[model samples]
Structures are given as C-alpha cells and as structure tokens.
Target: MYPVIAGGALSAMTFPGQTAGLSVFADPLIEQLGIDRSTLSLSYLIGTLLGAAAQPAIGRLLDRFDARRIIVVIAVLFSGVLFALSFAQEIVGLTAGYVGVRMFGQGALGLAATTAVAQIVRRRRGLALGVSGAIGSAGISLAPVLLERVVSEVGIATAWRLEALAVLLVVVPIALTLPRPAPASMEVQRTSTGTIIVAGYTARQARRTGMFWVLTGALSTSAMLSTALGFHQIGLLGERGLTPLEAAANFIPQTITALAATLIVGALIDRHDPRIFVVGSMAAMAASMLLVGIVTPGILAVIYGLVLGLAGGALRGMEAAAFVRYYGLTHIGSIRGLAVSISLAASALGPYALAVGAEWAGNFSQPSAWLAIIPAGIAILAFMVPQPSPRATRPS
Candidate 1:
C-alpha cells in the first residue's frame, strides 16, 4: 500500500507537463519547424487512444508475467523518455517522445498501478484504492502549480531535466519494493471462466450480459460533463464574475473534497448495494455539473467544487470497485480493459463536443447544463435493474 501510494503520487507528476507537451516547445520551434498544432495534438491523443485499446492485452500479459518487474522496467523506460525529450530540438522528435511518455507512462502505467492494487487487496479494496488514488490526486493538484513555479524560477528545459531525474531517483525505489509474494494457494488459479466471487454472474459472464450496459450507461453522461468541464472550470468560473484568486481558491478545497468523496464512497461501495452507490454517485455528479453552471456567489461554488471533486475521485475508484465486485479476480483484466477503453473513448469525444458547442454558441454559455443532461440520462437509464449475469461474476 505504501509503495502503491508513493509510486502513484510520483507517476502523476508527469501528467500536467506532458499533457501540455506541445506548449513546452520553444516558440521558435513552432514558427521555424512548420509543424502543425493539429498534428501534435493528434499524435498525443492517438497514443492514449491506442493505450486504452491495449490495456486488456497488457493486463492479460501482466497476469502471466511478473507485473512487478514490468512496472519497474516501464517506469525506468518512461523516465528515460522524459530525459531524452530534453535533447529533442525538432517537433517530430519532441512529439514522438511526448507520445511515448503519455502512452507508456500515463496510460499503460495507470493500468499497472491500479490493477495491481485490485490484485493485492480483497477486503476494503475500495478504501485502499481510494487512498492510493488520493495520492495521485494530490499529484494532480500540485503538479501544475508546482511546474508553474518551477518554470518561472528556472526554465522549462531545466525543470523537465530535474523532473526526469526526480522520477528516476524517487519512483524506481518505490516500484522495486512492490510485493513479490504470490497468492498463497493454487486454488485461486484454477477457478475457470465465470466463478462467482461477489454476485450472480461469474466474472466471465458479466462481460457478455446486459448488466454491463446498465452500469456503463449510468455514468457516461456524468463522465462527459466532468471531462469537459475539468479542462475549463477555472476560466468558466472567472467568467461568472469570480476573481482569479477566488476561482483558484475554489480549486484547492475541491481537491480535498474529491479526496474525501473517494474515501467515503470507497467505504460505502464495500457495504452498500452497487446500484444505490452507482445511482447516487451519478446524481451527485450531475448536480455538481449543474451547479457549475449556476454558482457565482457565496459558498455555492465551494459546495459545487466539493461535489465535483468527490465525483471525479470516487467515480474512478467506484468503476473499478463495482467491476471487481461484479466480476471477481478471474477475468478482471479483460473486463476492466474494456471498461477503460469505453470510458477513454467517450472522454475523447467530450472535449471535441465542448469545442463544437462553444463554436455554435460563440461562447461557453448555457451548454453546461445541457452537456450534463446526457450523463444524467445515462444514470436514469442504468436504473432499470439489470439482470445479473448467471455465471459466476463479471462485468464486461
């Protein structure tokens, strides 16, 4: 758990910087190199798209190989790429290196980190995963702010060099220290196909059933809204008349609130019906998005921020937890890979849709609530009480 938390925290540092990799290029490169901004974005986005599709295959391989070793090797390679990026003067080299980092570091590394947690913990998986995720959340909150300070004080090249070194030195030890002990008995390995650990369906059957639809549909819209707004919240809030400082203040508590939400929801996920947890989470998420469109005064923004933060943090953990409960450990890799793919694909559409809406309206007005409605609709649709798959337990 300690290694998981520490490694997750460090893994998150590269996200803010890599996400804006194109901007990290010198302006002279942009003008002199004739590289299209569209091409850079496409390369970055496509790498993650491929990562989503590749997750299951990676998961299946990890199941057979020494995943602990794989993670350490990948982490080392990721650090090497970051270090190499410092020397790339052309857009092609930079974009290619950035793409590699995003795919292996951000995308594949996520599967290794989170799925490894699920494999280790049986009881209180939610709480453990929640805590691990919060470590990453702390990184998300701190990375951009920290990078800004670093870049202003130093330079982008020097800061990135320092970042690569930090990852090499800090994350390597944590990754190397992950539990090497195997499951105690051969009994776990023999469970074939759809053995039910949690509910009606064996893990395999969950993949082929309608319940998966119900579950996926439940949160898609909420996901859409959250993904879109996450990129633009501070600016959106500022436009509503809040000062930049006030907008920034709202984000600080939002991170803490998200952490609290994940912890609480994780604990509840263990005890409560998944249906209740799923629907409640969706509704709370919708309310947050709606609130984002309305709150400009007093504590409404704070409260809204809290809701959004919790929704984001818990939702990721919940999706993992629910599937774990539904599917058990046998086929978790395959099912989760599919789930990650769906969510990532949908998320890809979210930002594009927001851009389209903004273009249509000439501003980002009124569309916020409308954008949120889709996820709410999904939540309502998922409430139709899916018939649990008949095998062991699984959600595909």
Candidate 2:
C-alpha cells in the first residue's frame, strides 16, 4: 500500500517532463523567446532524444543502488532543473533545460516509481500498478489545466518556480519514506500461492527474445502516435474545422474514458494474458488514428477522443505489470529501462514526423491515416507472438 501510494505520487510528479505538461508553456515560450513553433519543437526533439539515451544507465543505477536514495536525488535535481528553466533566455538554455527535465523528471523518476512498486508488490502487482497508473494519468491529464491557470495568475516564470518548489516539497519526503534496500540485495518472498521467484533476464537477453520486441513494438507505437497527436491536437483539430475551444473540451471525454479503461484493464490484467491488452490497445490506436483522419465538430470528434483514451489508458495500465509478470524482479529495472528508452526515443520522433508530414501533405489527416498502419501491423504481431516462459534461472 505504501509502495502503491508512493509510486502513484511519484508518477504524477513526472508531468513537467511530459509533452502534455510542456505543451502548456509552448506558446508562452515562443512569444517570450521570439522563436517559432518549429524551432521549439526541434529543441524538444533533441532534448528528448538525449534524455532517452540516459535511461539505461539510470536503470542500471536503480538496480545496483538504493532506489529511495536515487529517487530523492532525481527529485531534487528535477526541481532544480525546473527552477533553472524559469530563466531561459535563448534556445541553448531552453534545450538544456528540456534535457534535464526530461531525464530527471520523466525518465528516471517515473522508471524508479514503477520499479519500486514492482519490487515491493508481487502478489497482486497488476491491481497495484493499475491504481498507480490511473492516479498518475489523472494527474497528468489535469496538470496542463491547473498549470495554465497558474501561469495566467502568476506568469510563466513564477509558475515554473512554484512548480519547482512544489516538487521539492512533495517528492523528497515521499521518496524518503520508501524502503531502503537496493534492488539487487532484496530477498524474494514466496507465499502459499506457489509463487516461484526466478532470476529475470539481463537486458541483453531480454532484447534477444521475440516477445520483448513484440511488447516494445506495441509500447513504442502507442508512445509515438499518442505523443504526435497530443503535441499537435489544436492544429490538427483546426484542420478538421473544429474551434480551438471545442478541441480543448474534447479532452474531457478522453480523460474520463482513459480513467475508466485504466481501472478496468488494471483490475483484469493479473488474471489474463497481457498480450490481449496489448493487441486491444494497438487496435484502439489504429481506430483512433483512422477516426482522427475523419473527425469533425460533432459526435465523430467525441468518439475519436474516447477511442484514443481507451488506447492510451489500456496501455498504461498494463505496461509495468506486463514487464514484471514476464520478467522476474531480479533484473527488472534494467529490462524495463531498455524498453522505456526505446519508447521515449520513439516519442521524441513523433511530433517532428507529424509536423513534417502535415507540412508536406497540406493537412494532418493523410499523415495520421498513413501512420495508423504501424500500430495495425504491430497489433497483428502481438496477437501472433507466443508468450515467454516466466520460469528462468533462480535469483543469485
């Protein structure tokens, strides 16, 4: 219970590094810096890529050292990065700030939070992660609105500083309350339910398995498409003849549906093959993309929001639980890190790709429709792929 609460809270704190959270400040930064949207997008791309590159190393550290200590350091560093970002006067400073926030806030802290919960809660990991993911996602969905209000009241720089202060005040204390054992030294517990503790595969070994790639493909596809759609939501909806206000309001249905799906999927994932959810997520993503290509100001747009929410919510609910279920906790951090790095790298490319495609194609629809093929293909692969055996070598 402590682990779940800590994980959810920590996950919620990752908003500053998320694309949706950053999107709130986009127009303000552009106006302040005298840069165009494309230039800002480029900076985000480079920063996110560099941040993604650091996850594997961070994951290795989590595996070897005390996760609580590492999370505290990351939270403190993330707070400092937010504070520093409030002072950016040029693109270099902006990009540098993005790198720090993305690495410490999004990449490391989120990974640590989920990994911590995965380490501590083995018996009903799916339900625990589902609750955690739902809390995190709800907070993420609401952050932009709350931050926008703050920015309106206090101005951008002060809002950022306040965010920094909030993170420092909130995260460090919660992190300190977590268990102090290093992941490598923690003893595995078995219960009367015949839970066999096994040594998880190394990152290298996990990479070699077909199932790893299948899961990665599904997760990466979701990350890429979802990020792209979110990063350009206003523009894309405008292209389809919807007012900006209506477009923004569409997120309400998406959030509600996402929360519902996250809870439902989370509750059921423990008793089922997680691959089913992966396939379902991909299918929903494909449908949502197709819907985006044809969405308008009426019921179609609402339906699109609901479907997209389903895809994102289901994926989030199952991801951490799937990894832990398939791979034992022995080296879970490294394995999860490798997959997250790939997903983050994919996310980094999404907005830029969509921006380019929209520019070349004269609208968002054709590009979105074409991109749907990626997830559609991955869905088939997820359905056909065999599940990996969880019984590996015993933990050393």
Candidate 3:
C-alpha cells in the first residue's frame, strides 16, 4: 500500500508534463516565441512522437533496475525541462523542451510508477491501481485549473519555475520513499487469502498472440478518440450552442464521474475478466461520441460528458491491468512500454485527424460521428481477445 500510494503520488507529478498543463502555456508561448498555432502544434506533435519512440528503451531500464531509481531520475529531468521551458526564445528551444516534458512526464514517469505498484502486489493488484488511479486522476484534472490561476497571478514564466520547484521540493522527497521490487524468489509468494500465482508471458511471447494486438487496438482507440474530443471539446460544445463557461463547467462533472468509474472498475477487475471492462468502456465511448455528433439538448450533453468520463477512467484502468495480468511482472515494464508507445503514437494523430476532418467537412459534427466507429470497432476486437496463457518466460 505504501508503494501504491507513492506510485499514485508520482503519477500526479506527471500532470506538470501532460497536455492539459501545457495547454495553459499556449498563449504565453505564442506571445513569447512569435510562432503561429500551426507551427507550435507541429513542433509539439514532432516532439511527442519522438518521446513516444523512447518508451521501449525506458521500459527496458525499468525491467533491469528498480523502478524507484528510474522514477527519481525522470522526476529530476522532467523538472529541469519545465524550468528550461520558462526560457525558450525560439521554435527549436520550444521543441526541445517539449521532448523532455513529454518523454519524462507522460511516458517514463507513468510507466515507472505503475510498474512499481504492480511489482509490489499480486493478490490485490486491481484495488491498489484503483486507489492510485483515482488519486492521480483528481490531481491531474485539477492541475490545469490551478496552473491557470498561477499563470494569471504571477505570469507564465514564474508558473513554470514554480512547477519546477514543486517537483524538486515536494515530489522528489515522496518518490524516494517508494520500495524496490521484491526479489525473484519472493515474486510468486502468496498471501493467506489463497490467491494462486499465475505465470505470465514475456513481451515477445505475448505479442505472438492475437490477444495482445486486440487489447492494444482497443486501448489505443480509446486514447485516440478521447484525446481528440478533449482537444476540441470547447469548439464542439460551442457548435451545440454552449458558452465557453458552460463548456468549461462540464469538466467537474466529467472528472467526478471518471473518478467514480476508476474506483468501481478497479474493484471489478480483481474478480472479473478484464476484457469485459475494456469492451464495455469502449462501447460507452462509442455511444458518447455519437451523442456528441448528434447533440441537441442540455441533458444529452451532460450524459455525453459523464459517459466520456467513464470511458477515460476505464481506459486508464485497463491499460494498467492488461499487461500485468497477461505478461508477468518479470518484464511487465517492457511489455507495457511497447503497448504505451503504440497508444502514445496513436494519440498524436487524434487532434490532427479531427482537425483535418473538420476542415474537409466544414464542421466538427461529421468528424465526431465518424470517430464513433473507431471505438465501436475496437470494442468488437476487444471482445474477441482471449486471455493469454499465463506461462511466464525468462527475459531474453
């Protein structure tokens, strides 16, 4: 539980490096760097793509060493990047800064934290992740709002510096308290509750099964669809006659619903087949996207937001559970890293695709309707994925 709590805390630290946090800096960056939206957007896409490309390597490190060490190093480097971002004078500097933030914050830190928690517990893995996810989600959801206030009060540069200080002073100390993984002989030791140890497939062995690809497809589709809606949420809501304030106000309902879903789904995952949760969540996302496409009223929009929140929570939970449940913790980091990289790479295209679709169709509605099919398809694939044979293999 201590490791899980520490992991959750570390997960929250990534908020400073996530899209929501960085979105607050958009206006400041444009003003300071003199670059148009497209230029900055492209630079961000490139940097994020580069960051996604590094997850496999980072995952290998997690497999080789204590996740605590990897997490601490990433925390330090992520803070430095945030601080450096405060001084960017040009596009090159801005892009470089993004590479550090996205790589360390979203990719490596999350990988390390989840790996740490997963390593420590097997009998109650799902519940631990649920608690961690709930805490991390709340922190991440509030981060942009808090940072916005800070930026308004003290300006963007100081906000970045303050964020850096928070990581250095606050996060690093807590992260250092995380325990290392148990030794190999103790890895399969069981509790008095009679939970039997199941051997797991290695990353390479898991990839050979259709289940791997199906799970990846479902998870990545959820990431891409949700990210697209979130990126254009304001514009989409406006098209349905909601004011900026109304659109922004939906965040609280969304976050609360998501938090509830994370906790509920976490408990269920411990007892039921994960595919059930994954497929159900994807179906919810599909319905939500369809609702957004055909929006006409107040209750409908609220329902859409709530369902979208459920999808988001389920995606996070399943992504955390799938690799550990299928591939053993022996190389869980590497297996999950491969999946995370694919999802991250797919997420980069979400906004780009939606924007292009909107431009081609002249409104967000058509794109929203078209995007609905993606999750629906993935849900079908997720339904077909069989549980991988729990035969653990030595890392090659």
Compare the candidates by TM-score and give the number of the best one: 2
Candidate 3 lDDT over residue span 1-396, tens digit each: 777677788888888778878888887778878889878888888878888899988988988887777777887888899899888789998899888888888888888888888887666788889888888888889899899999989987799899988888866787678765675333553446554455656678878988788777876787788878888888888888888888877777779888998888887787788888878888888888888776654787788789989988886776677667766777778888888888877777888898899899988888888888988887887766667776633333
RMSD of model 2 against the true structure = 2.1
Question: Would you list the clashing residue pairs of candidate 2?
Answer: none
TM-score of each: 0.82, 0.95, 0.94
lDDT of 3 at 342: 85
Off by over 4 Å in 1: 1-44, 88-91, 181-205, 214-223, 385-387, 390-396
The 10 consecutive residues of candidate 2 with the worst lDDT sum are 180-189
lDDT of 2 at 297: 94
Model 1 residue 361 CA deviation in Å: 1.3
Error of 1 at 229 (Å): 1.1
Clashes per candidate (backbone, < 3 Å): 17, 0, 1
lDDT for residue 115 in candidate 3, whole number 0-100: 84
